[model samples]
Target: MTARTVRGAVGATLAAALITGVAACSNPSPGGAADAGGADSAVVGIATEPESLSPLLGYGKDGNSKIFDGLLTHDAEMKLQPALARALPEVSADGRTYTYALRQGVKFSDGAPFSAKDVVFTYRTILDAKTNNASKTELDAVESVEARGEDTVVFTLKYPYAPFAERTVLPIAPEHVAGGQDVNSGDFTTRPVGTGPYLLTGWSKGEKLSFRANPGYWGGEPAVKKFTMAVIKDDDVRLTRLRSGELDAAILPPNLARAFEKDGTRTTFAARTFDYRNVTLPTQHRVTGDLAVRQALDIAVDRGAMVDKLLDGAGKPAYGPVPTGSPWFTAGTERAHDLDRARRILDDAGWKAGEDGIRVKDGVRASFPLWYTSGDKIRQDHALAFASDAKKAGIEIRTEAGTWEVIEPRMKTDAVLAGGGSPADPDFDQYQLLTSSLGGDGFNNMARYDNPTVDRALEDGRRSGDPAARKAAYDTVQRELVKNPGYVFLTHIDHLYVVNDRWEGLGTQVEPHDHGLGSGPWWNVESWKPKQK
Candidate 1:
């Protein structure tokens, strides 16, 4: 459940096919990774790169960090599988205590032994207030983590958090390597040592992340010996590189993915994801802060048309973070695209249309700047479409494009075309998104949404272990959004990738919103094998 509030705003190129490792090629030009490595190496083109490689700083927090192993990991079916831990943790009767038996003889890529102490250090350091991890609150259920001898570790929870076991998927860092230095700004942040299938060789920010398979990996060494993730921010540029053979595989938007449909050499893989694109309505802004404006905008947007046109039938219209097909979704919570109802709501709220056809209320025009990350064609299309839809309802929305650097500062008062979702559990995404305490806390609540009822419901949903109780709690949260809409949810997009059909064992997972880095068809890249000639 790594919500991509910051990185989502950063332009990302999607993943396409199984990639062989590339040598360090920051800019995608001819003579890159595709030429350097043979069949044993693979190179992939992705849109974005992580800010830090360190697990301590929220990298791999949702599992599948290529450089590190978590206590548990999700399989192809999105089910939990043991990694550092020998098996699933033993839960207590009260559901407040969890005990894990460490997998013995496992060592980090740097050749250091992995033990219960390493687990303790990772959890303790992240939970520390001084550590600048924005995701520490996800572990708020933890009361204490104690090491039992060298082989066992135990976690005590403050409440019977139902998804506490899921949270254990967080990657563990070596205590000896990360503990001695500054947890926030340390060499380990860039050069991390972990017990995973690969080792980080180099990270060229805004360019590429280079990796080599760990020879001494606990799970046998990868068949693809070298791997490089070329960071190409523009979708068209990524497609160009992929077409020219500079990239082996890459994630592309649905419209762009169609270009390779007739190409026999490449196969397109469409992964079902919980990724939703929504517009953040900042509560601090005079226009977006109004309940009437929020409700009208929510209903005025045509989500079905967006799915049909922008996504080209690759995704479904979204009503909220929980997809309509999801069992957790409330049946009656879907918002209809009713232009008349939207006009009536605005009219009743005293927003009168001027001679210019723009709504004005009490000398303030119903207009605000909406920002999307520049160079992202998908986001640009969504922003343009949203602005067009809003125009019909007498509202003037000015859509702008900028990098996250320019947009982050204005998020408190301006709207943003934001994307985020998690397939794990409702609590995984909803708690951080809807909690009142997390408002304006660095991307936790980008809209600065503060609703007491939704906040209470999120707390109850996460704290309770009972399935019925959690369902009812989340139902309330969704229902309350209908009455007081904070974000205009657009679509739940399926991740589409095109890849060179060069390897076996290539598949996709039920991905989160934050894809490209640890998702796409190459999520299980370690298990991939070169196809026989």
Candidate 2:
């Protein structure tokens, strides 16, 4: 397909919104008047409003965390734990089947009893072609789901997908509430009901969202009384609000989080995350289209310097798609800075350095606009640093911080500073963003990369559950991808948050790209307790 068509198709959805999460929240029971105790409520600042609360949309970008309960949830350490389910899922040794035992007597916020059917409906909706969730690929391994009984839900996967358990960290919506509605644009998209510990009391859109505790929560009453998620897109404004006591907590860039440490306004909570940040080089563009230029761009970046200076050493350089210590991480993928080699590679590829120090090939100057969210200081810093490093390699990188709406159309031709990764494994990490088949879904494969070798290895990894086989397959994928790098990876950021000390239950979270306001600091708000008198 042509470049323009690709951009239009992919940019329409993926860039719009989506992501992973937790479930629960506070007092006055759900929907009761914001009691006189509203002063004790926890207010958080988020960078974006959620695209939708429907689990079909991966619980959205906004982090309305308390309203939905997933079959599985992550602990503060990011390890898999049971939420709606009674306990950890039982996986078949063959790797194709997963069985979850529903927690009996659990009730949705609306008072409906939780059932295995809810689990079945959730997956069925996401897999259905009519469902509009762009992140459906996260569950692509599931071939079928069946409610074997009132308490047991079984999932049959197409393969022994290694990351199947983590993918279950999705909200299980009540069928009685959302069943017949349009799965794509249903009432549940905005108004949600699940077996979570809180109810979504209010959503003002672009302003703030309100929540109250689910009194019938299976886990017992949460200590927090009321919860508010305020949308503050500007990084500085978010910090300012936290200082002024407008918000009890906020996620800040590493530098900003560090600044607040000594301010005494809020205590910084830094957590390790699989949130991988990389610059996608769209192959459709002439400047970035050249494979040699892409490789040189990879070598040109000083990943260590970006980590040290930009992140204030709060992050580690990302070599491949996975974290450094991950079993799937390919050690050979990590490389040291070699600027002379980068320039030589470009020169050998027929790119000639002009008098102005910009590389030119044919009639095209090696220049393209790099896009990022304007409010994200992390991406902005990464972009500026990227441009500086590219200049050294005679490749001009013009950084543009456009709103997602503005950046969507240009995703076809421009490079983008994007962030994503999964709590699952490398499959979740690589499949959506790197695969060629998933290109039209906004953020997935925005780079427009196509390589049959890498594709086959990725397929192999997904199609088998044998550890040895999967390892062999993924190992090949890493090596092949590094040989023709599609992204100039910078650093895997440590998600940082600052919260007030009024409550005692807040804990660190293993965040994903889809972190919502509720998903981070508020993951277990229901468990937070006021310091005892």
- lDDT computed for candidate 2: 0.76
TM-score for candidate 2: 0.90
Poorly placed runs, candidate 2 (over 4 Å): 1-40, 60-64, 263-265
lDDT of 1 by residue, 1-533 (tens): 24434432231111111012224323434444344236888888898877667788788988999899999999999899999999999999999999999999999877889999999999999888777777788899999999999999999999999988888899999999989987765667677899999988766666678889999999999999989888888888889989888788999999899999999999999999899999999999999999999999999999999999999999999999999988999999999899999999999999999998899999999999999998888888999999998989999999999987788889899999988999999988887877878787767888989999999999899889999999999999999999998899999999999989889999999989999978998899999999888
Distance from true location, Cα of 123 in model 2, Å: 0.9
> Which residue segments of model 1 deviate by more than 4 Å?
1-37
Point to the candidate with the largest lDDT. Answer: 1
lDDT of 1 at 257: 97
